[model samples]
Target chain A: MKYTEEHEWLRVEGDLVVVGITEHAAEQLGDVVFVELPELETQVAKGDEVCVIESVKAASDILAPCDGEIVAVNDALSDAPGMVNDDPQGDAWFFKMKLDDMSVLDDFMSEDEYKAFIG
Target chain B: MAEGGQNGDLQRTVLHDLHLDLGAKMVPFAGYAMPVQYKPGVMAEHLHTRAQAGLFDVSHMGQVILRGEAAAAALERLVPVDLQGLAEGRQRYAMFTDERGGILDDLMVANRGDHLFLVVNAACKEADIAHMRAHMDGVTVTPVTDRALIALQGPLAEAALAALVPGVAAMRFMDVATYDWDGAALWVSRSGYTGEDGFEISVPEPCAGAFARALLARPEVAPIGLGARDSLRLEAGLCLYGNDITRDTTPVEAALGWAIQKVRRRGGAREGGFPGADVILRQLETGPERRRVGLRPEGRAPMRAGTQLFADDTADTPVGTVTSGAYGPSIEAPMSMGYLPAALSATGTQVFGELRGKRHPARVVDLPFRPAGYRK
Candidate 1:
C-alpha cells in the first residue's frame, strides 16, 4: 500500500491510482459516518483540496494528493460511511484519478516512509 | 457486573480493540476511550447520517434494571413521568429530581413486564444509581454495566434492521423488543438521540465485538464516531444533556415541557409526587420566564454556544446566551438555539448574536432550523 504524509493512500494498479485515507488518520478522526465525493471530471492537482468528510464532531476537507481528473468516487459512502474508518486503506477509496504527472508520486511517502513520518 | 477495572482512572470500554481495528480516532469521552470521528471526518459524517444511516457505539452509558412489586411506585417518586401508566415494552424519557426540584439526571425508563429498565447518561450513571439505591426500600436497582449499546440511526435504519429481525420494521417509535442475531440477545429499541428514525441495540458486553463486527461487515453499515453523533443531533435540534439542558435549566425553559404528558400534570393516574412538580407545573400553567428558541444568523459566520445574544429592541443589549449552535448542513445556514426572555422570543423577532467582537444580525424563529426526519 502506498502512503502520503497527509496519511492518505493510493493503491496503484498500473496507472490508475485508487486513493483513500490512512489508518492513522482514521484512528484520530474516530468513527467514519459521512462522506461527500466530488464530481467526475473535476480537475484536481496534487496538493489541491477536493471532496469532504465528516464525523459526529467535526468537518474536514479531503485533500487531493495526486493531480488528476476525478475518474471515480465511492458512492457507497452515502450508505456505509464507516467504510472509511473500518477500512481506511482499503474500501474507502475517495476518488480515483490518473495522476497529472507521475512525478507527483515522488512527493508522497511509501508505506515504510509513512510509518517513520507518523512516529 | 464486571464494571470493575479502570485503566488508572482512564476508562477503556470492552470494545477498544474493535474500535482500533476500525481505525477509530479514540479520545476521552465520558471517561471511556471512544471514537470522536472516523476517516470520513465530522462534517461528512453529520450530513451522511442525515441522508443515510449512521451507527454509534454508546456502551459507556449506564443501564439498570429495577425489580420490585413497587418498582413503578419507587420510580414515580424520583421522576415526573406517569410510571404506572407506562406499559411493558414502552419507554418514557424522564428526569430524576431532588426535593427542591433540581434535575439530577435525565433517563429513559423502559417497562419490561416485571422489571423496569433504565438507560442513564454516561457521566451521571454512578450518581443515578447511588441516589436511586438510597431512596428505595424494597426496590432492587441492578446496574447492567456489563452491556454494550449500539445505535443505528437515520432514514434507512428500519430497513437495515429489518434485514436482521423480520418484525423490527413493524415497531414504531419508542417501542422495544429482543432480536435474534448471532446468538446475542439484542434488545432492540426504536429510539435514538439524533431525533431520527433509528434503533438502540443492547447486547451482552461479551458478545459486543461479534455484534459490532457483524454490523460493520454489512455494505450499508458504517461506524459513526461521537463527532457525527453530535452534529446529527444538533441538526435535528435535539439538545445535548449537559450542554443544552442542565440541572439549572427546566424542561419548560428548554422547550421540553411537551414531553410531560398532560394526564400526569393533574394528578390523574400517577400524581402529586416526584420532585420539581411544583415549579414544573407552574411553568406549564404560567408559561416560562425564558423559552428556548432557534436563532438564524444573517451571515455565514458560525455563532457557537455561550455566545451572547442581543435584542435589537434593547439597543443591541444582551438578552440571551447561545446554548448550542452550528452550521447546519441540512439547513445550509448558521443556526443556533438558546434561552431568550419570553417576550422577545417570538417568531420573526429580530435579534443579534455577538460573534468575534462584532454583532451579527439574527432573528428568532420556531426551533429546528432544518426539517427533522424522525420516523414517526
Candidate 2:
C-alpha cells in the first residue's frame, strides 16, 4: 500500500491499483455518509479529483494518486458509505484503476513516511 | 476556516480545558476555541442527543439582563414579538430587526419576572448590545459576562437533569425558572436549539466546569460539540444566526414569522413600534417574494452552504442559495435549508442544487426534515 499527501492510498494488484482514503483521512472526516466515484473507463490524470467523500460535516474531494483509467468502483458504498469509516483500507476501496504508468508509484509515500507527514 | 475557534486570538470557554482533556477536536467558532466534536464524533453525538441526552457548552452565547420598569416595553422596540403579553417564567424566540426589515440578530428573550433575560448569538453579541444601548433609554442592558450558558438537550434531558435538580422535571417546554443547585443560583429554561425537550442553564462561570461534569456523570448524558449542534439544529429546521438568517434576510423571508405574535402584526393594538415594523408588517400582509425552505437532496452528496439552487436540472438560472445543510443522522439523508422564490417553496417542488460544479436534483420540502420532538 502507498499513500499520497492528499490522504488517498493505492494498492497495486497486477496492472490495476485499488484506491481509497487512508485511515487518518477517514478519522479526520468523521462519519462517511456519501461517496461519489468516477464512472468506469474514465481517464484520470495524476492529482485529478476522481471521487468525492461527504461526511456529516462537510464534503471533501478525493484526488487520484497516479494517471490511470478508471476500471471499477465499489458499488456497495452507495448503500453503506459508513464502510469507509469502518474499514477504510479493505472493503471500502473507492475504485480500481488500470495504471497508465506504474513508474508514478515512485512518488507515493510509504506507511511510515505518510504517518510522519501527517504528524 | 474550520469551526473551532480559528481566525485570530481565540477566547476560551469555562469548559475549554475539560473539552481538551476529553480529547475533543477543538476548532475556531465565533472567536472562541470550541469543541467541534469529541472522540465519539458528530454522528454519535447527534444520535445520542435524539436517543438520550447531550450536554453542550454554549458559553460563547452572550447572556444579558435587562432591568428597569420599562424593560418589556424597551425590548419591544427592537423586536416584533409581543413582549408585553409574555408571561413571567416563559421565553420566546425573537430577532433584532433593522430599519429596512432585515434581521440584525436572532435571540431568546425570557421574562424573568422582575427583569428580562436575553441570550444573543456569540458573533453578534457585542454589536447587539451596542445597538440596544444606542436605541433604548431608561432600561439598563447589563451584559452578564460572569455566567456560562450550557444546554442539556434531548429526549432524556429531563430525566438526566431531574436527577441533579429535582424541580426541573416539573417544568414544561418554554418554562424558565431559577433554582438553587449546589448553593449556586442556576437559571434554567426548558428550551434548546435542537428540536428536542431540553434545558439551557445559565451557571456562574466558576461553577460551569463542575456543573458540566456533574451532568456528564449521568448515565444518560454525554458531551456534544458545535458540529453536532449545527447538524441537530439544521435537522430541526432551526436557524443559525450567521448562516441561515442574516442581516440581509427578513423574518418573513426566513420563515420565522411565527415568532411574531398576532399582537404585533397589522391590526394589533401595538402594531408598528419595532425597528422594521413598516416593511415587516407589509411583508406579513403582502408576503415576501422569496422564502426559506427545506431541501432534500436526491442523492447522498451533501449540498453545503453557498451551494446554488437552480430551477431546473439544466442549471442555467439560479433561483436560490443553500444557507445551512448537513447529513441529518435521524433523517438518514442529506438535508439543507435555503432561500427560494415563494412560487418554488411548495412541498415536493423539484429543484436542483449545484454542488462541485454539478447539478444534483432536490425537492423543496417543508421546513424541518424531521418532526420536532419537543416536550410541550
Candidate 3:
C-alpha cells in the first residue's frame, strides 16, 4: 500500500496510480457515502487536493498524491457512493493523475511504514 | 466506541481500527468514541453527500424492543401517531408528548408485530427510556444497545444498494425487512434521515463488521462521519430535536401538526393522556404564535443557529431566531431553517437575518430546502 499523511492510499502500477481512501481512514469515518473526484485531464500539483469524499455526517478532500494532470476520474462514485465505504482500497479510488513528479513517491509511506506509522 | 483505559473510555466500533489508521479526527458523541471530521474537513464532507451519497454510523442511536400485547396500546399512549393503523413492516415518525403537549423526543416507530421497534436519537436515548418506563406498567422495554445502525443516503443510493440487496427496488418507502446475508441478521429499512432515497440497516454490533464490509465492497459507498450528517439533514429540511423542537415548543407551533394523527386528537378512544394535548390541540385549531420555515439568505453569508431574524419590511425588531442553518451544498447557496411568527411565515415574505448587528435580506421559503425523495 502507498500512503500520504492525509491517510489516502494508492496502488501504483507501471505508470498509473490507483487511488482510494485508506482502510484506517475509512474505519475512522465509520461509513463512506459520497465522493467527488476531479474531472479527467484536470491539471494538479503535488500536495494539492484534487477531489472530495463525503460521508453521512462529514465531508473530506482527497489530495493529489503527486503533481500531474489527471488522466481518469472514478465516475462510478456518482452512482455508487458506498463504493468508498465498501471498497476504500479498490473502486473507491478518486482519480488517477499522470505523475508530474515521479520522485514524490519518496515522500509517501510504504505499506510497512504506513502500518507502523498508524500504530 | 473507545475502550476504557481506566480513563472512562468506552469500547470502540468494528471500524475503529480503520478510522485510527486513516488519521481520523475523533470526538465524543452520545457516550461513544466517533469521528467528527476527517482531514478534508466537515464543510466539504457535508456538501459532497448532498450532491452525492453519504454513509453514516448512527450506531449511537438507541434501538429498543417493546414486547407483549400491551406494546401497541402502550406506545400509542406515549406518541401521537396512530399506531393501530401502522401496518407491519412499516415505520412512522412520531414524538413522545407530555400531557402539557410538548415534544419529549422524536422517534421512528416500527411495528413488527408482538413488538414495537424504536430507533431514537442518541442524545435523548436515556431520557426516552426513562420516560417510557415511567409511563408504562406491564410492558417489557429492552434497550438493544448492542446494535449498530448505518445509513446510506443520496440520489445514487438505489443503484449502490440494488446489487447488494437484490429486489430492494420492490421495497417501498418506509418499508422494513429482516435481511439474512453473510450469516448475519440485518433489520433493513428503506428509510433514512437525509431527504434522499436510501436505507438504514441495524445489525448486531459484533456482526456489524461483516455487513459493513460487504456494503463497502460495493463501489458506491464511502465512510462519512458525523460532520456531514448535520449538513445533509439540514439541507433535507429535517429537524434535529434539541435545535428545532423542544419541550418549550408545541408540535403545532413547530409545523408538526400533521404528525399527530386525527384519531388521537381527543375524540378517539383512550385519548388526551399524552402531555401538552390541550395546548397542542388548541394551537392546532387556532394556529401557533410562531412556526418553523426555511430562510434563503440573500447573499453568501451563512446564518448560524441562534441568529435572530427581523422583518425586512420593517424596523430592526427581531421576529424569529434561526434554529438550523448552513451553506447548502446541493443549492450552492447559504440557507437556514427557523421559527417565525405564523402570520409572517408565508412563503415570499421578506425577512432578514442579523449578522454583527447588521441585517441582510432574506426570503421565507417552505421547509425542506431540498426536495424529499420519499419512496412514493
Best candidate according to lDDT: 2
- What is the lDDT for B35 in model 1? 81
Q: In candidate 1, how many Å is residue A65 off?
A: 26
Please give the TM-score that candidate 1 achieves against the real structure. Answer: 0.75
| Candidate number achieving the greatest TM-score relative to the actual structure | 2
Candidates ranked, most accurate by TM-score first? 2, 1, 3
- In order of appearance, the predictions have TM-scores of 0.75, 0.98, 0.73
* Candidate 1, DockQ score (0 to 1): 0.12
Question: Model 3: runs farther than 4 Å from truth?
Answer: A1-119, B1-11, B39-44, B266-271, B312-317
Model 3 earns a TM-score of 0.73
Residues B90-186, candidate 1, lDDT per residue (tens digit)? 8888888676555678889988888999999999999999999998889999999788998988888777777776788988788878877777788
Q: Residue B84 of candidate 3: its Cα lDDT? A: 80
Candidate 2's C-alpha runs over 4 A off are: B1-8
**Rank by DockQ, descending?**
2, 1, 3
In the range B1-376, model 2's lDDT, one tens digit per residue, is 1333233589999888899888899888888988889999999999999999999999999999999998999889999999999999999999999998899999999999999999999999999999989988999999999999999999999998888899999898999999988988999999999998899999998888999999999999999999899999999999998888988999999999999999899889988799889999999999999999999999788889999999998857899999988899998999999999989999999999998888989998887888888878
Quote the lDDT for B151 in model 3: 85
Please give fnat for model 2. 0.82
Task: Assess the local accuracy of residue B137 in candidate 3 as a C-alpha lDDT between 0 and 100.
Answer: 77
What stretches of model 1 exceed 4 Å from their correct place? A1-119, B1-9, B267-269, B313-317
